[model samples]
Target: MSLAADLGIAFGRVAFVMLFVLNMGGLLTWVERKQSAIMQDRIGANRASILGLRLFGLFHPLADAIKMLTKEDFRPARADRVLFGLAPFVSVFFALTAFASIPFGDTLRVGGREIPLQAVTLNVGVLYVFAMLSLGVYGVMMAGWSSGNNFALLGGQRAAALMITAEVAIGASIMGVIMVYGSLNMMDIVRGQGALLWGWLPAWGIVTQPLAFVLFLTAGIAATKRIPFDMPEGESEIIGYFVEYSGMKFGMFAMADFLETVVIAGMTTSLFLGGWQVPYLDAAGVRLPWGWTWALPHLLVVLLQVGAFVLKVCAVIFFMMLIRWTLPRFRYDQAMRLGWLGLFPLSIANIVLTGLVLLLWGGRP
Candidate 1:
């Protein structure tokens, strides 16, 4: 294929993936609300329907989009209009960009052409993910500061500090993963997990690094600034960083939250649950019969691998959504304490323990 043609094909495929992710995230907002309402024993969004069709709150997302579209797109008179416009855009844009390096699934082959699901397989994918996640704070900070509102400023300050506290612990917690895998490439980490531990439990990161998994989960929750770590946008006591934002602008920030959830879920799959490789599935992938030729085996193998990957990703997403609804929001000081005094020490301990495990097991994990 010509280089230009190849580039076009790659872009087209990526566009499709982005659209899929977008629609999924939009749906998730309604799901989160409906699920949250169900937990609280109330009708979440039954009032929002189309043609008298409730569809179990399926139409809520469309309703939300319309509301955001018609709402006044107002800016504070004293706010920096340029930065105000850019703030949510920055938040949503970085959230989307962070997904670029993730390996969603394995490659598929058709007529001798193989297409990989990952957008860009950068060598420093892990670092890049972290960097983008950290940068997410700036969007909030800018939004709050540029609003020229005291409440917004306070929220932004809280967000910055909250992010730093959680990020340090989060970064420390994942060091063990790096130590074990010895590579920053997320694809390689998943590939490493395909082996079995003593022929039993899969050698997924969670199996081998159980403590790290817990710590990582905790920090991830805090990093994403959801409940139990939502000090930055505590709706009750303090207006959130984006309090000044409205209309589709605010919708972008809301959408970014859902996208970040998906990103985290996907990363969890790649990091701990073994990306696209089921136990015993080799790096090149499994094989099956393609009618009457050798191509059959290759096709089957690829199909199995894709199935495995989707299963893993779905499992992760379910777990995250469960956590979101099950937990209560943490108070600002409590969240801070958990991040610093609690998670920080635990993360450091995990690093130390991981080293010992590596020394004893010769890094087989």
Candidate 2:
């Protein structure tokens, strides 16, 4: 392919990822309200509508956008103008960029060329995503410290501490997966998961590294800083990091949180689930364990893979939202303790166990 074509493909992938994430993040706002309402046995977000058409509260996100856009943008009298203004953008930017490395489908072969379905392909994609996610804390710190509010500063400190605890546990937890897959590339790891164990069971990360999956999901939830791990924004007690933000600025912060949740779900899908890999399905066709072989077109196979990825991601998001409504918020001290004294050591132990199992099995999974 020519350089121009390559660049075009890259841009197309980027556009696809951006649109998918942004739409999902926006839709999640409605999902949260509706799902919570179902759990609590109440109507939620049905008030927003146009021309008497509610569309089952789907219009609420649009209503929210209008409200945020029309509301007055406020800044503290003693705030640092530049950093305070830039913080929300930083948070949203990193959250969006982190998804670039996640592969939603296998390569699409078209007209003598193969195109990857990911926005960006990198050998160290996992580390790249981790770095991007870790950098998001800077935005939180900036928002808090520049707000000129002691409460905000305390929230920022809590966020920083929680981030440290979560990141460490996350890093340690994924080491077992890295050992199992023997790859740092996200695509490579997902491809590795396509292998079948004992001619039947798919060799997914959750199958081989169940412990890592649990550890990673726990730490990933903490990384997103949602319910049960929302120490940075304990609205009932402390107003938390972006307390001084208002209008669209506050909306951006909120959007960043949802984007982070989507990223976590995507990462979990790529790492622990099978990403876009469908069981008994390969590039050519479906190969059943019981001696049945069904051939499928390449385009159809690609579509199936992509569809499976989307479904997996949505399922993970639903589970996350379920947890959000089912669990109460964690106290700061309790969250910190869970992160450090609980998850961290357990993650380390999981790594050691994985290494031993890999060694005993001749590094095969």
Highest TM-score: give the candidate number: 2
Clashing pairs in 2: none
TM-score of each: 0.90, 0.98
lDDT of 1 by residue, 258-289 (tens): 88777777777778777777665554543222
User: What TM value does model 1 have?
Assistant: 0.90
Off by over 4 Å in 2: none
lDDT value, residue 228 of candidate 1: 66
The Cα local distance difference test for each model comes to: 0.79, 0.93
lDDT of 2 by residue, 1-365 (tens): 58888888889999999999999999999999999999999988798879999899999999999999999999999999999999999999999999999999999998888998999999999999999999999999999999999989989999989988899998999898888899999999999999999989999999998988998898899988899888799756768999999999999989998999999999999999989999999999999999899999999999999999999999999999999888999888899899999999999999889878887888665
Name the runs in model 1 displaced over 4 angstroms.
280-297
lDDT of 1 at 152: 91
RMSD of each: 3.6, 1.1
